[model samples]
Target: MTAMQRLAGFVLVLGFCIIFLFKDGRSQGNLLTGKTVYVWDFATRDGEVNSLTGNFTEEFEEALIQTQQCIVIERRKHQRLFEQRQNEKGIMSLDEISNAEKESLKSLHTNIVVFGDIYDDTEAGQLRIGISVQSFEGEILTKTSVLMPRGKKLDAESRQMAMKELVQKLVSGKDPRPSSEPIVVEVENVRFELKSCKLSGGNLVCTVVITNQGEDRELHIYLPNTRIIDSDAEEYLVKAATIGASAGSAKLVSGVPVKAILTFGTVA
Candidate 1:
């Protein structure tokens, strides 16, 4: 065979190899990356009410306080309930909650809801979080959450950090007080394509087209970068994509298609 033919053959075989080996991994990672995470927010329904005096004797005041207490208590209960559900039934979203309870919870808060999931991965060595936020009217608010993972070998602190970040993202909006960071994930560009792929000399290259994607998560996209792809790409691929890094996640802003490039190749 001619050298040109050999080169072509080599290229084809190398391309196939790179794609074959990493294709599934890439697909899985991207699938997870492009996931329409149903960030399940704990439903909220209660008129905002605060009293420094703790004075409440009217029936309406009693009911309001009871309603607020129920909201907080229910959150605790949900912690256990959702934990159990996750163990036995898999991750639970607020949407999975019974309709009756949904209505009841809806009556508690007209402005906020909480929902999310924590994913553990040993390969990426980090925790992945996906959250869904919805309004009291049952409309999806935001289906984004930050990922937190144990950066190193399994240790108590790493595990604790993961859980802490997970919880922070899950319930960051609940607190009226300001937080160092917010919980929100925005996909600026979601692209998909199949093209020449190869792994040579320790470098892998696969060109990818940037698709229109991203959420205007103002302060919330600062959560640790989740391992969407285990490749030779820099972490900034995800971080630098944003205009600026804020300390927290963004609020749910919808109706806008995340700017995405329809196609692109992978290079490593």
Candidate 2:
């Protein structure tokens, strides 16, 4: 080949090599993997450091998080309303029922959503966390906004507690309620015994034994006020019994050992 042709070939190869190298670098620094993003602060002449709490930084982040959370809450409330419509079916207004009854129904149907708005103060030393909950319908339930003294924090855990409190308050129809401590219930050797029986009267005396298998856990046991769900006559006899004219008797047998004996007779 001629020298001039050889030189031209070398130049072309070099150009291609440079182009390939540039492309590889471009791919590595692509936004998908994350690249340094800079925002021009019109307030600060040319640009400002992208540090939390500067002026644009914390506000921008807080706005983004709030918008995202609002969208999520809106969607959740829509879905919950759909579910409530399905569950209510033919039922219209619950006005006729007792207030207690209406509350019980509401508890079964209502839905709550919790979220957090996180940002930093101007100094960027304190992180601000706003724990809040909303009804599916965009109504604010409970909000506890506090500035946590931390550089960064994950709001998930705090948000969860905030939600739990909100739900409990909403369900109870109370505001400014006391915070709830963690509660766990463990039932061990729960057994039933028949004390007495009268076939014709359909009355049987029965006792329920519930032993605290593990650590102490506060419990509220609802005796069979109505017929036990999906229970046969024999099973119901142990759980429910009617003595004479009285409907039933329930005894709270728990201070430490945690044992309860309920006896009642059912009229046949």
Candidate 3:
């Protein structure tokens, strides 16, 4: 069939797909992979930078490097340059910098900036530190935090655990979200409710619940016409089928529900 036909067709006699139903058209790569990150020294509740502030910046950057996903931009050199320019312009922070200054800083390989804030919860006897990840385009991607005893910074193991949580949050934020409502397709008086699509034993398996909405009928299904097309336009044809109600037969009774599994062995 033509590309146009495939573009509009996910209806297989027993074939359907999970195309872009769960995606938002963004790059589907792991969140931090190759992303340029710039982490700042955390500001304490007193509005001052202390040793704890420096440790937050260093440890967080180290954790990001260990993942080997993002490109951690060295802040020292770029920060010195930024300071020198800011001094000459009599400005202090990013908020005071002009649009021209932001544009000029594009030479630095950077995508997101991490700003951290630490609060001393004396009553709770805990130190709460949160980091906000913001795109250079001014979008807040995520806000994550960890709490430790009020004494000082996190212990080695605690630091690792906290960093892992931060990484998990970043990765999950970029993943495709499930539909808010059920996805249903109707064809020839039959309704197909797409339950889920998953991979098993190296094959793509799509689970569907099929129901006859009209009178009992002969549902002639040409297997070759059934396939799964992904958002990348890659196609996987139906290789095997297991229909729970009729033992793979196509006869359908009105209002009868049948659960079926369509396997696409062409998956790689």
Arranged by lDDT with the best first, the candidates are 3, 1, 2
RMSD of 2: 31.2
Worst 10 residues of 3 by lDDT: 84-93
Model 2, TM vs. native: 0.20
Name the regions of candidate 2 deviating beyond 4 angstroms: 1-110, 152-268
Question: What are the per-residue Cα lDDT tens digits for candidate 2 across 162-264?
Answer: 3344333323333321124211222242222222111222233223233434443333333432222111121332343322223332222334332233333
Error of 3 at 146 (Å): 1.3
TM for every model, in the order presented, reads 0.30, 0.20, 0.46
Tens digit of per-residue lDDT, candidate 1, span 1-104:
35453343223322333343343332111111111222233211121122311111121122322322223323333443334333233223343456655555
State the displacement of the C-alpha of residue 219, model 1, in Å, after optimal TM-score superposition: 39
Error of 1 at 8 (Å): 34
Off by over 4 Å in 1: 1-74, 77-88, 91-94, 150-268
Q: Comparing candidate 1 with candidate 3, which one achieves the higher lDDT? A: 3
Looking at model 3, residue 252 earns an lDDT score of 69
Which model, 1 or 3, shows the larger TM-score?
3
